[model samples]
Target: MVAPTIQPSLPRVSPWALSSFWFGSAFHWLLLLLILMPADIERLVGSAHKGTYLGLLSGLGAVVALVLPPLVGSYSDRVGKRITFIRWGVAANVAGLLVMGFGLRAGFNVYLLGFLLVQFGNNFATAPYSALIPEYVAPAQRGRYSGVMGLLQLSGQLLGGVVGALVGTAVVPRELAFVLVAVVLGLSALVTILRVPEPPRQELPADTAPRLGWLQLFAQNAFFWVFVTRALFSLGQYSVQPFLQYYLHDVIGRFRLFGLNLGNAVTASSVMLLAIIVGGVASTLLAGQLSDRLGRKPVIFFAGSVMAAAAILLLFGPPFGGVLLLALVFGLGFGAFTSVDWALGSDAMPSRRSFGRDMGIWHVAFVAPQLAQTPQGRLLDWGNALQPNLGYTLVFGIAAAFFLLGVVLVQRVKNLK
Candidate 1:
């Protein structure tokens, strides 16, 4: 019998590049929680149609996130440079933040426009940046690097929670917080420009087209299934995230923490976020390393199970202690999922030559959940109308269902072992 050909491994990337990439990831997560979540909540707080408005903004963002990434990523592939897109995207994000800050101060409609711009800028940066992983890291080492990225992302989330807590306690102006987030994003861009040199471009075929249509590219692709799994998992994970502050404040009611007078919803939500960060950081590090050895499927299955259980616990478990435990559990699952899922997707790439385009296509998984967020939000509102805090219960149940569905669907992936 003929033996299967063995592929040679790519060279390992430098520490500087890895660190810069991690920093960039960290900054991205930090800004997402620190600026976007709080700003959105602020916009919708007193509105009579809070759920509808939040859903509309989220849907608009989903649209931007869906459309821009693949197009920009394909463009980057054609040009053979991801860094330029990253730079411009970061700049655009900063401009969006400024617009958001001013718009928030002025009116809700203005802020909605700014929010859309932010989504465009963020998706543009992320799609190309994600493609860099395959470009820079060897396949064998993708998990380890993904773990490091996840750890940094959790750390950023932890810090963002702390900042949010401070803001909740009136220690920082929300406008100043937005400015700080923009500055951090700018600094991260600088680091990327300085330390993370773009990989040499793959020479395309002589007759290669500049862009492949999405439908053509997606047909018969196993990565599309990976994309579906990710969308379901993210939908479950994010179901509560956007509205968590309100849930804690409005449903759970104010309660003392650590004998200090921190009873506000934002503070409570931040505390829970901190718990999640701690749990996630540890699991992410371990899961990433383990996936490198055991393959991505097992880690993802385990993580998804844990996440589903956590969501269930949050719905029926005890109040304070249960909440804390559930947060930790959720974090553990989220961290593991975050670490392995990227590696899993990377393993399923259709072509290396079109990494940017393909990765952009993969990113639609993450953005597609935003489309559901509106309906989910309306669901929550509907539940609340029937009974107090019932909306949150419905949301958690739906989230659990999504997580379990993801767990089941991930088993269908036949490409990765």
Candidate 2:
């Protein structure tokens, strides 16, 4: 009888590395709260120009996102010192937040400058930070690890929302919120710097340099399809997000929560955040494991379907309870998507040598959607002009379409099961 063949097991990851992943993910999600700050801007600018101002702000953010991450990622790859970049990026972010706090007290242009600084700094850190995942985790374990990261991200988002809601209630000053986020970001960075071990430096032969140019990679690589799917899906989600508060306020009307009368925007936002936190915990914990067994495509497809359904439900203008139910569904979908998508992207990466660069390019998928905010805002204004809340209706419909398109396009990726 022939001896049985033994399969090689993946190397075990350190506890410190896992902890770093958790903290890094938390920082990423916490930063997402910046997107929700247009309401604060509205206080300064007024309602009529809110869309225009937001368009300009998001556009500036997009410019930073477009330029910084890949540049920093490429530089870090060359230097073989990703953590150094991360530390510098965190310091820049803290400085930017401080400037923003002062700027908000001074004028809009100053606030814009500070916000742009924050964007550049955050993206600079994120590129190298995200590239660390594949270096640390084994292919067999990427799914499980991605799940944990997703859970931490959701937890961070929940925390940020709670903080924002408290600020809305005057329980904390608005500037204090910026301080809090900065502190959290700084702490997370410190933890990552101390805990996560860097990957061994690779010394490649001069003749073996990456053959494909960056732009060529976009056309010749299958990973670009992954980028496309993520970008389109994000565009769909963002098309409505900047306008959600306005919709809740203007269209849904105000209602009381916890015996304290609150604006419809705040009440709805709080409820939705709660629903996301509750629903996301389980989905995020489970989806990655399921994707490991069932394949990434199925989990992603299911998530897209669920998200599309939630978007369609929103189009009906449901009651508050119904809205909560829809939010739960959306959270479930988003949780699963967030958990598995990173693993999927890692699986499709073109070359390990260019992980940072490729991932930075992938980061563009995220920023590209920011550009959509302008068009979406314009669409909202035009639709509302045509009919009351027509803009919101159009937004949801467009969101659903993009979700479905993402689901379909993901099927085109042949590299991963």
Candidate 3:
């Protein structure tokens, strides 16, 4: 007998609690990318090979990111458990991070293993966790909730940068940063698990086929364009990001702007990142609420343009202070785009039955771009060999083109809102 419906189509979930895990996720990512990895790679390989080695590390680690999420999410979908998978991932992550700390002293291969494990652990947790919003939140509320997601996510990143800055200044031991990351991950995840109840297990209909892995998802045109646009934007970002510390060191060094002397390249990089995060935090929350009322495309349009303009401006040799302002502008636009990110994805998901599998597939847009890091590094290296600091100009130009292209293409997405 069919049961009569007794409640709303979706369950009530606290946006704050729902977004707690994002903070943990963004925290570790920034911690590693901004400080830990760069410092270690530079020490191990020297500055000349730093870009290439770092790219290799990212490319290798992303193999796990590319292959693991769909498999893990598909299994979680079958088993019908989210928190258990997430907890197990946390255990793995802590182990990996600790190993990385020890590996800092041990050797490069050992350090690589730690990074790979970190990827494994992070992807395993996130694949299952990614499905929660679509399953729990009402469509009308998604923008605001997504805003909350971006807000906490950036806030986490800000804290990570702060940790990096502290480490850069030698206020905190590098090893201690790993501990801080592990503790934060555990606490935030505990809050999410405690506050957010998992929905009851669902059974696949008799006729519905199980959603296969990544390739099958490409056949859905609506999602394919969404994936493409997102990948382009991310590619633009990774193009600049993976080499930002190097850019700071090589291009803009020892500038005194506004009575502030930032002679240290690492400290200068942290300041720029902080400026970006500050702008990002403000816009992330605002844009999410705006996307709810104004629609996703319009907000996305504004965001992409802003980012493109910033990238183009960066190609010009701006003063150190001017660059900081440009960074803030870039952050504002990027934050707005991210605010609407999940709402758009939720809107375009191909099948309700395969939220886990489909979201896992969708997430490849972010991961796939990391694969380009090797080529990007090679480009920088190649360009620099030909001339001095021409690599930064070439890279910045590439980033601008990516931003413009990504912005223009968003209009092509069906009016899913």
- Candidate 1 root-mean-square deviation in Å: 4.5
Report clash pairs, candidate 1.
Answer: none
Candidate 3 lDDT over 127-152, as tens digits, reads 88888887788789899999999999
How close is each model in CA RMSD to the real structure?
A: 4.5, 5.3, 2.8
Top candidate when judged by TM-score against the true structure: 3
Candidate 2: give its CA RMSD in angstroms. Answer: 5.3
Tens-digit lDDT track of model 1 for 139-244: 7988988887777777767777777667633676777767767777687667767777666644444443333466766663567678889999989866867777
What is candidate 2's lDDT per residue for 1-417, written digit by digit as tens?
322111122245553455453454454444333333676578679987777677778877888898878788777666666777788888887888888765676778888888888887888888887777765677777888888777877777777666756764577676776777788778767877877756556454444325357777777546888899889888877886677777777677755545656655754676676676667776986998988888888988988899999988888777666777888888898889888877887786766566677788888887778888877877887888889989888888999899999999998888677
How would you order the candidates by lDDT, starting with the best? 3, 1, 2
Which window of 10 residues has the lowest lDDT sum in candidate 2? 1-10
What is the lDDT for 382 in model 1?
88
Best by lDDT: 3
CA-lDDT, candidates in order: 0.74, 0.74, 0.82
Clashes of each: 0, 0, 0
Q: Alpha-carbon error at 36 in model 3, in Å?
A: 1.5
